[model samples]
Target: MTFVSFLRKNLQKEIFQVKGDKLIHVLPLAKIDKREAANYLCVSVSSTNDVYITLLNVMEEKTVLKCETRHNWLLKDLKLIDGIDQLQDNAEFCLHFDTKIFNLEAYSTASKYAFLRCLRKMSSKYLQYELQWIHFDQDFVGKSHSLLVPDDAVLSMQICLEAFTCACLCSCF
Candidate 1:
């Protein structure tokens, strides 16, 4: 099966299970200003080992927002007021993406801790490599290394490596 289909099937099966109920909460982070209304924040792990956070409309049982922790995603704790006059009592943490941000609030302290632990655990599994380096050893020169390299330098190095790999492959044939 295609990856999308597999993900959807796994999400449907895991998100509706009895254990998934614990992850459901009325998160006030919804676009609607009605804090009293019930909205669901659901976190689930797909069969493919991907982590997903979904915001649901409890009344309609429909997803309002869904995010996967694969690309350009960050989870942070909203501890400080950061000059805001007041913060919501339930406002405990937030999930940040490249284009969107979700302020997450839990039903209780324990729930907040649990969610944080789960998110952190999942997020830590994916590591984005910022730079690549190649090492050469010789008798005259033991080893050489580059330090404090800029982003452009790293990109150039990666491009050079790719070009070298392509050249070697072409020469072999």
Candidate 2:
């Protein structure tokens, strides 16, 4: 996976591994906004404690297992990725958006065209990016490593670039 996607994958993996008390709370995620892609819109978020709990109803219903977290999921899965500093303070006017949460399946495969096209539709709606390039390696930082064509990694890179850009815009605006 590209470094960005690698970070995202690791971030996604970390979401499930979040220890007690450190868990990122669940919140309502909007699929779209009326704002332009270059800006991060400020919208109130509602807390959802039973967000994943609803999966109980779909399990016995059908093959709801397409892409999922390490723990398995249905309809949607939630992930939180962020730095500790962004949320170090909590008070009036505090923002819970220092970290980002991804709600996609744990696994997926799409080509560049299909991925970018898909992104244009439901994408974060929170971010946008002009993809540069992507390269993958077992250890991206290793000098002796060889880069491979990023199949899934490219899709994730697209997501992260867009999400990071969204976060920056939100904070600046």
Candidate 3:
């Protein structure tokens, strides 16, 4: 079988694939045409290639990019990627991440303030992270987060992301 076919077949397994993520990457998806329900995303290849993958209607996903992408210890440069010259509003990004989780519950409010209060309750209270996205699943699913980020006590974004990460981590693991 061809390499792509092999990857596709393996990915189509009936049982849940126990894929271990030693490295992480991100994919940016955008909603362009509603009638066709078409979407476009830029996924990186091991931090080597950053190419654009287009979907005509969810099943017709094909890569039209010429570059590669990969995971990096530092923030990957978006300028290096070819297809991301411009960004659309409400673009959805998928970032691969492996992080610790304890608990993330809300009773009163779902705002950032309430979120941070719960995160600080963790025993490992100071884990850092970058803002990736919120995840919800049927089983063994909660908010998904990137790795704990570096220290930054100044920016408001840092405060919010860090808190949400901690809260989500507490609930997930």
Query: What's each prediction's TM-score?
Result: 0.37, 0.19, 0.21
lDDT of 3 at 49: 29
Please give, for residues 1-173, the per-residue lDDT of candidate 2 as tens digits.
Answer: 55334433433344334421112212112223334111111111113321121111011126322223222221122222111121222111111222433232111222222322222222233233222212212122112122573434554565588789999999998
Instruction: Tell me the alpha-carbon RMSD of every candidate.
Output: 20.1, 18.9, 16.4
Residue 137, model 3, lDDT: 15
How many clashing pairs per prediction, in order?
0, 1, 22
Native-to-model Cα distance after best TM-score fit, residue 91 in candidate 3, in Å? 6.5
Clashing pairs in 2: 68-106
* Candidate 1 residue lDDT tens string, 51-166: 55666543322654243323221122222211111222233555545456455555543334334434444455532221111121111111114447532344346547878999
| Candidate 1 local lDDT, residue 121 | 46
Q: How much lDDT does candidate 3 score?
A: 0.27
Compute the lDDT for candidate 1.
Answer: 0.39
Off by over 4 Å in 3: 1-26, 42-57, 60-146, 149-156, 159-173
Cα lDDT, all candidates: 0.39, 0.27, 0.27
The lowest-lDDT stretch of 10 consecutive residues in candidate 3 is 77-86
State the lDDT at 33 in candidate 3. Answer: 45
